[model samples]
Target: MRTVTVLGAGSWGTALAIHAARRGRPTLLWTRTPEHQAAMAQERRNARYLPDFPFPEGLRTTDDLHQALDGAELVICGIPSHGMRAMMERVAQDFATRDAPAPMYLIAAKGIEVDTLSNMHQVLAQELPPSHRGRIAALGGPSFAAEVAKGLPTTVVVGSEDAHVGMSIQALLSGDGVRAYVTDDILGVELGGAFKNVIAMAAGIGDGAGLGDNARAGIITRGLAEISRLAISLGALPATLSGLAGLGDLVLTCTGGLSRNRRVGIALGQGKKLEEILAEMGMVAEGVKNTKSAYRLAQQQGVEMPLVSTMYAILYEGMAVREAVQALMGRALKAEREW
Candidate 1:
């Protein structure tokens, strides 16, 4: 049996660990805090992140990163995007000091880095040795942690610079309840994952305002067009935008009630203060950070993305949601299609 390690005990990370163990692999899950590690070891459940899903019998929990990863065949790094750089630094140091290295690293985080404005895959490449970059891959698609843990059928994409590595991840992770597809164009997969959170915010705002399904559908459909345009400018194939990582994930996240980012947008539409909503949720919504990063990227690529720009303003500049909506509606019309 192969050994798999997942770093992070958040809902997503726990769900991944459970799934890996259920697939007949011995899984090691890491949490940064010693308190959390002690709790999971004795309690057999992740308290804050995934309370309902107990850590499986085949899963091991630990606070030590190296101990969790040592001799593992595949390491699933599941930390949030904001904390990624620091975690990667630890990973590199651990690998460098090891008598021998183990296997490829797979990233399960979703969001663009707020500081460097880099996607998760780029951060992986930047942090890992050059020879190991090819093994660094990303996973994104139609999934919510809660649903996945309950044995709901879920599909996602595993993207790497090397198709062979992507396929290996798919083979290891996909099971009866979880499905994974592979891609060599890592940029497209990462881009699709990052931007979907931003678009979900707009959809949530529509939901909160009680604007009816028409508005929500409009936001989802148009928001997809904007992402497609942006992805094309960044060297992604057009068809990738419609695949599981793009259109499929967009629909699930924008419409799914489990998304914290969508909840944050909903609160905003209801006229709640951002600080209040963030405090209440007490988790990283991701769209809250990705809006700024994606907006800047759109400008750099000369990609026209009014929705992303408007969301950024509402989130950062204290603009009202209604006014942001108005700005989008008032923009002048062109031929209405990008070739």
Candidate 2:
């Protein structure tokens, strides 16, 4: 069996580790928190994140980075986007000094970095040595952690600059209840995963404000148009935007009650402060942070992402949610262009 290691013992990371272990791969899950590691080791469940779901028999948990990474043939990074760079730097240090072979990397985290505005793959490329860069891949789509851990039907796509790397990830992760597809459009996949969270937040805000299904649908549809435009400006294929990573993930996150980003938006629309909402949720809502990054990136690339811009204002500049909605509705009328 291929030995796999998953960094970050959060819900998504734990779920992916469980899936891999159930597929008969020898999998190890790493958590930086010693308390979390102890809890998982004793209870066989991540009580903090994935409390109800017990880990598979074949899976292991650890706090030591070296022990977790030892002999790992495949490394799936489940760390959140904000901390990914620092985590990768640590990983690179280990790779440099350790005798263990470098593993193929599959990044499952979604979102652009806050300050650098780099995608997860870009963060990996920047932190890891040049020799290790070519082995990186990204996995993204509409799959949720709870459903995936329950072994419900879930499908996702893996993308890489190297076609073989994408296919290798697909082969390693695809099984009875999990489906994996391969793509060479890494830029499209990464952009789709990161941008949809921003749109989901907008959709949630509409729902929270009782704007009705019409308003919510409008946000989702227009959100896709904005994402596609920005992604194309960044050299992503327009067709990839309409596929699972784009439209599929967007629809699920915008409508699904399980979405942390959508829940954050809901709280915001209900008149709760962003700080309070985040404190209450205790989970990383990528959209809240990604809003600023996406907005900055849109400006940098000269892409018109009005919804993203409005979200940035609402999130970072203290603009009222209703006022933001009004601004969106009051925009100058123009031809309905998808680009």
Candidate 3:
């Protein structure tokens, strides 16, 4: 049986670990908090995040990083973008002295790093040793943890610079109700995953403000155009934006009720303070932070992302949500540009 280790015991991580374990893979789930590890081990569920879902019997829980990583052939990182680099550094240190085949790394997190403006894969490369860099891959698409845990049909894409890496991940992860596709456009996959959250927020804000279905549709459509432009600016394939990791995920996050980023935008549109909304959420909405980073990246790359800029203003500059919408609607008329 293949040994798989998933770092970070969040909802997504736990769901993937459960899937792997039920597939008869020897899986170890690592949680940074000992209390969480104990809770999962004793109750066979992650009460904090995945309360109702029972863990598979084949799944193991641990707080020890070294123990979780030992002899693992595949390591999936579910840590949030903010903490991803630190976690990778620790993983690198754990394997520093051991002379063994490097495990294939599957990054399950989606968000651009706020401080460095680096995507998940870039952060992985910066932290992991040179030999391990080529082993990195990213898993992305419109996947909700609750649905995946319930064994609902879910499709995702795994992408890497190396064709072999993408293919290998697809073979390992695709099974049962979960379908995995391979792509060589890792840049497009990662950017699409990160950028969609911001667009979802825009959609939620429109819906919450009672902006009508037409407005929501417009936001979703234009928001995708902006995402494709930004991704292309970063050397990503344009067609990749039309694939599962881009258009599919964008539609899901923007329209789905389970989206945390959309919920944050809804609260903002309802006139709730950002701090209060975030405090009540009790979960990290990547859009809240990614808006700023994405805005910065757009400016740095000379990409025109009016929606992302407006979101950054609303999120960080205290601009009213309705006002932001108006600004977007009132932009100078121009011919349709899909670049």
Candidate 4:
């Protein structure tokens, strides 16, 4: 019954819009690129991104911001983290024309800001009004767009500053196949989603190097410890890290074979150039961007995450992956547990 505005027409954005449309919501999806919007509108299919998934009849498409978000009861922002601030600024300028509505603002993006190192909700509060901050929520877990668009039995966490805000989102979308869980730890959910991409890349590198499951399991377990450590340092609940946002997402993205970031590392492990691998992928692999941010966050928080640091080096500093592996393996063995 809610008119949802999905403010991005990329793969994940279109997929989420399709889910809402399938639920019989009056969904409006927007694409900033005029050409993409036109194609999706004229063809009634987002062939560029969500191929084979037809845009539902009652669902709408637009290039104009005002037209898409106007009368929207829920705004689902699925843009990448790098563009989040700029997108919010453009939307904020347009918001001045309309009466301030208390619509639920959902962040479907999945990375921390590179410069500010802020979570998506913090980025929202910085760009939007203080009054709007309370309305902000995050939807994240280890969900592949293709699976979600196909109506797989997927479960995800909807987190907010208020437990009721998450519950409201749960009530808004709960149905037969998809399950939504509510939490009051938006920060944890967002960070877990962002950082897991980095660890998944590491796991992928292990797999590509033919290191076997023992190495991948080690990376996953240690990566989760670092995720929980960083999250707790930022005022998030430890249990939230163990939930869908942390452990569930880590398992899925690192080993699920659908992660683009993991695929990036796979090519790198096969001795492919970073530029070549990235060019072939032709997508926003968040781990490539998150590596620097995660390493920095770990350093600032005094959380020792050598794996994240070494991965950042491999991605940013021209360090060889083999050398990175040697360094990790050669580090002085301390207590296995950090807790």
| Segments of candidate 4 deviating more than 4 angstroms | none
Per-residue CA lDDT of model 2 for 138-253, tens digit only, reads: 98799999999999999898989988888888998899599998888888898999999999999998988899999999999999999999998988898788988999899999
lDDT of 4: 0.87
The TM-score obtained by model 1 is 0.97
CA shift of 29, model 4, Å: 0.8
In terms of TM-score, which candidate is stronger, 1 or 3? 3
- Candidate 4 has a TM-score of 0.97
Q: Going through the candidates in order, what is the number of backbone clashes in each?
A: 0, 0, 0, 0
Q: What lDDT would each prediction earn against the true structure?
A: 0.86, 0.90, 0.90, 0.87
lDDT of 1 by residue, 65-134 (tens): 8798788888898898899989988888888887665478888888888777788888878988666777
Off by over 4 Å in 1: none
Q: What does candidate 3 score in Cα RMSD to the true structure?
A: 1.1
The residue-level lDDT of candidate 2 at 123 comes to 95
Model 3: ten consecutive residues of lowest lDDT: 330-339
TM-score of candidate 2 to 2 decimals: 0.98
TM-score of each: 0.97, 0.98, 0.98, 0.97
